[model samples]
Target: MRIISGKYAKRNLFTLKSQKTRPTSDKVKESLFNSLGQFFAGGQVLDLYGGSGALGIEAVSRGCDHAVLNDVSRAAVAIIKKNVALTKEADRFDVTNMPAKVALKVLAQKGRKFDLVFLDPPYAKQQMVKDMTAMKQLDLLNDGALVVAETDDQTDLPAIAGFDLLKEHHLGKTLVRFYRKAAE
Candidate 1:
């Protein structure tokens, strides 16, 4: 796969040939970034259930200061490391081989708050619900932070309390839902 824009535009990245890993499509990534506008610049991002580390890497390419990537699979972590190295972004990222909740707890303990968080877990796992819930409970999100969730077009995300749904884009079978934290 390739980075769609920003400093790393058209740059080639690494990916693993595993059934569990599904990289976000270029079209979807492009659309998501375009909508992000200036929000991605100089932000801290979290890529939960990160597959190829594509989303976080893209954020860094667009000027995000740093990204923390978490995945439960060892293979996914390895691929994310390879992709980060391929983009020469090893210094801008961290990879955790653990479930989303575990990673969330660790980040919260570290007092880390992200400006943007990407969630694209396996659709059937109903991971969006659990991850968002944990994020809210842990208060890991920054005020006015953005959350991007990619899921099968059919999956319905819960109406999270602290977040306001910003936009929803349906690109064929995949749906990208954008949300922003509500003012306190």
Candidate 2:
């Protein structure tokens, strides 16, 4: 897959050969960035369950200051690194070779905060609710940060705890939901 817009628009990104990783479709990514509008400038982003690092790289290409991509599989992480290098954005990204929850815990402990966060876990895991809960517990989210969750249309998304539902879009079989952290 490749970046659909921004400075890296039409740029190629590497992919994992394994069947375990599922990359987001171009149509879905297009709809996502469209919905995000011009909010990416100088933003810090976190991409959980990042497959090809498309989402994070797209954010950076659109002016996000930096991005952290996390995935459980070594192959996925390797592909993310390669993709970043291919896009000439290696300096704008960090690759975390670990599961979502573990990466969130580590980042949170380091007091890391992001302006945008993307989550696209394996649909078979039914991991939406559990992951959301873990994010809240680890305080990985920041006030007003936008979290985009891409899941199978059938996957149930939980009621966001510290965030408010901003919008939801359905792109064929993919469901993209946006949430913003609530202000105290």
The prediction achieving the highest lDDT against the true structure is 1
| Residues 1-184 of candidate 2: C-alpha lDDT, one tens digit per residue | 7888778889877888877878888878988999999446587999988899999999988889999999999888888988888777588899999877788889988999888989888863357667776777777777778888887888876676677889899899988999887776
RMSD of each: 1.5, 1.6
- Return the lDDT, model 2, position 95: 93
How close is every model to the real structure, measured as TM-score?
0.94, 0.93
What would you estimate as the lDDT of candidate 1?
0.86
What is the Cα-based TM-score of model 1?
A: 0.94
Please estimate how well model 2 matches the true structure, expressed as its whole-model Cα lDDT.
0.84
Q: Rate the local accuracy (lDDT) of all candidates.
A: 0.86, 0.84
